[model samples]
Target: MLENLGNRFQDIFKKVRGHGKLSEENIKEALKEVKMSLLEADVNYKVVKDFIKKIQEKAIGTEVLKGINPGQQFIKIVNDELVELLGGTNSRLTKGVKNPTVIMLAGLQGAGKTTFAAKLAARLRKEGETPYLVAADVYRPAAMKQLEVLAKQINIPAYIDEGNKDPIDISKKAFGQARANNYSYMIIDTAGRLHIDEHLMDELGDIKKAVRPQEILLVVDAMIGQDAVNLAKNFNDKLSIDGIVLTKFDGDTRGGAALSIKSVVGKPIKFVGVGEKIADLELFHPERLASRILGMGDVVSLVEKAQEVVDEKDIKSLEEKIKTQQFDLNDFLKQLQTIKKMGPLGSILKMIPGMNSDLGDLAPAEKEMKKTEAIIQSMTLQERKKPDILKASRKIRIAKGSGTDVSDINKLLKQFSQMKNMMKMLSSGKMPNLGGGMPMGIGRGKNKFF
Candidate 1:
């Protein structure tokens, strides 16, 4: 998401670390580059200026210059500042003391507000919260229907009134229905307009008064960069939005909006839309994002994602197989499915430390994974458990089935053997150093075949 900005910082650090001892002049030169980088990222001019000033004030001080690993210390200073600029911490939704805490989502017409409502509902349901969807957007074409369809997909009940035209009445009725049905949470998707106006603001105000939403979330498109900041400001001016939901965070924006909105609009970003999938909305963590922007991947988040998709029973079984050195193609395919369920392969890889800018590596690694999965799936049950049974003759058959060649089959078999041996070492508390994400027998050096 912050690919451009990340590369710039990574480059600057490369230069910083290259020097044995950095002088004040050297640090100033680097911050100059940093200033240009932040400015080019479309960050608010004042935020950038203040951010750079804060870093420079600390970066050249005697405390850092004389510290061990001064260059790394300087980088840490910059990272810390970035975190502060990005909201410093997460802001969670406040649970109402009363039943059915209402959360009203407001955004521009095409900002994906309706879809995010369903996503939030799904998240709440996953967490044992009985969240109901209120399709109060009666103005847009098919907006309420879209919400109903999403609610159905997630098996959550939605409050929709085809006969009701006033959003205020629809919201009020929905709140009453939530109480009647014992819903703990209610996400009301308010109607959006092409642009802010008195009419739209008045409607939103009326609905807000009717429901007294616990969280008034302003959804903004991340692809618009600083323009999103301006939009957020206007919404906050009228409604004093409690937080922000930056949609299309996985898009090709320079990440300026995410870095600037809190400073401009004075509301923490509560969630970010990482992908189009309903499961893609993530609770915003500013520190994790700051680490990501500095090319230091978020391993904690990666583990959390894996935990979400990996079943405990399956994990125990997989552990047994790995410990016994009996992992088979079946186990491998199951692991691939586990990874897929977590998220996109590329996105998952980016969460690993030092892999944020490894898109070049991930593309081919993903391709190899898919090809390996295909070849393994084509094999018979016997061949999967005992690869030695796959003689030259069987290799040809598997190649034909998988639309691959015998040579491809041979390479996969060899890699699987190496991986098995590697697993044995890992199980015995021995780890082969995989310099730079080159997993055992997977990249360069020994087993670069894959």
Candidate 2:
């Protein structure tokens, strides 16, 4: 979603680079471009106006830092303002001091309330908290069953009183069950309803009063653009929500909701549903998102993602293989499998500095990874461990089995050999440019498309 915005910023900065000392005209023209870019991104017009005003105020009289051009100085100013406009800091979900903390989720229909509840539970479960899902969404067909299935997949307990149609009754029983079972927290998945539905609002109000939840979160669909801002306002006005959970955050939405919700609703977005997987929810960090929007990669989020899915045993084994100079096709395939778990390769690379826009334009990263994996899988065990023994005849057989030409195999071998050599140098304490060595089409400085 930020791809276009990043490209726009890059273009504007290139134009700014043509100037030695930025004049008032130069600043005005650049700010005009920035304003247009923000408007095109679906940001609130008032927010854009104020954002541009601040940037112009700071950019007009700012002295360029030593060794930095006016373009870079302007980028810094924009980055700072973007950070502030994006909430200036991370808003973490607060854990209740009392055990069995009740957290109720409320939102409009089709806003992913049930799904976000399960995602939140799965995330909390990963953090060693005993989270239980409460299926109080009695209105939606199969909503309870849906929550049950998701909980079963993650091995988390779920409370579903399918016989009871009253959401209030279900919520009361779920809380008791959670407390009786010694659970740390209970996430109540309430029924979704539009803000205009007074009957549904009364039902939600009854549930809130009965449960007295410590946290009332609103699950919002981020794809609705400007309507998301209005939805948040209405929900906040009625429920006085503690924070927000944005679903479909990884979609191709214009990102106006994320940029506008906080300012319009005065509520921080606590978490974002980044993917469809149960483990794909992420804590929302305003500063990191601002950085990504400005074409700077979010290294912090990348590291956090790595920590979540990385296996210590696999890391140790891979290190041993690298240190012994025995890393081969099998290890390479294993590495690809790990990357797959880390989410899409394109999404991952976008988090690395200077690699913001390489994936989509340069190559199909996910397909390349899959193709590489298939090629590796087709090779015999001996061939994977010892590629030197593969002669021309064997290459032909392997190529046929892997559904590729001999050239693909040869290219893979060449890249593998280069990677092995680079690993050897790194083991001996030499830092080299990774841009030329990345497996997929990920690059930074003057590298060809993979």
Candidate 3:
């Protein structure tokens, strides 16, 4: 999402590292470039100015200028400042002392508040919390229905007051129902408009007063740039929002709203909507995001994501299969599905150290995975278990069923053979050849992985 800004920062750091030593002039020149990059990224003018100023003060100090690695020291200073600009630490959702903590979501009509509500409920549900979705958006057509459907997808309960038109009344009743049912959390999806208006504010205020929510999260679209920051300020002025939920963070965002909102509006971004999936919501972490923006990658977050989707027992089973040479196409398909559950391949690659901005395009890799899945699905269980029995005629039939050329099927089989060979070598404590022995469609031929 912050690809451009991240690239610029990485370029600037590369130039700094190229120099044998850094002087005050070197620091000044780099900070000037950094300032321009932030401005070009659509960051708020005041926020950019203050950020550059802080870095300048820290970089020019004797502690940094005389450090053994001045370039690295300067980079650390910038990273620290970026973390502070991004809110210094993670802001957790508040849970009141009483039961059934209530959270109210407010934002523009298309800001993804409804979708984020479902995402949040899903996250809480995974945490062993009984979360109930309160469809209080009585204004937008089908808003309640939309929340209900999303809730059903995650197997969470949702309250919809079909007869009630008042959002405040609906929220109050939903809160009562949640409390009576002993739900751990009640997330109210409030109505929004094209823009902030007095009526919208009044209605939200009435709901807040009626429910007395433990937290009021203002959902801001990260793709809107500085407008999102201004919107946050306006909402905070009217409703005193507790935290921010930056939605569409996986879009082609310039990174302005994410960098400026916390500093300008004095609100911590609690969660970020990384994708459209109900499991795509991530708790916002300032240091991890700061590292990503600097092209440092976020290994901590990567490992956390892996832990969330990869089961230990499944891993052990897969390991035993590989060691026993019993892995088949079915097991390979299962591994592919598990990888898909971790989110997009491109986003996953960006989280690895040293793989930050180097991945040019990942479309081919994604397409290859989909094609492999199609071919495997087209094959029968017996074929997956025993690929040796398949001849040219069977290959042609499978290709036709999967809507691919026979050559594609050949390449997939070749790739699968190479993968199995590599696994065999590893299991036998031998190193596999890497020159011409690499998997087809991975780093060789026209169908590169990236």
Specify the poorest-scoring 10-residue window by lDDT in model 2.
441-450
- What TM-score quantifies how close candidate 3 is to the native fold? 0.91
**Candidate 3 segments whose C-alpha is farther than 4 A from its true place:** 61-71, 428-433, 436-440, 444-447
lDDT of 3 at 71: 64
Off by over 4 Å in 2: 18-23, 361-363, 426-450
lDDT of 1: 0.86
Every candidate's lDDT: 0.86, 0.83, 0.88
Q: Highest lDDT: which candidate?
A: 3
Q: Write the per-residue lDDT of candidate 2 for residues 234-336, one digit (tens) a residue.
A: 8788878899888999888888888888877889989999889888888889889988887789999898878767888988988998998988889888878
Best by TM-score: 1
Q: Write the per-residue lDDT of candidate 1 for residues 178-245, one digit (tens) a residue.
A: 99998999999988999999998988998888889998999998999889999999999999899999
Q: For model 2, how many clashes? A: 0
Error of 1 at 373 (Å): 1.4
Ranking by TM-score: 1, 2, 3
What's the TM-score of every candidate structure? 0.94, 0.93, 0.91
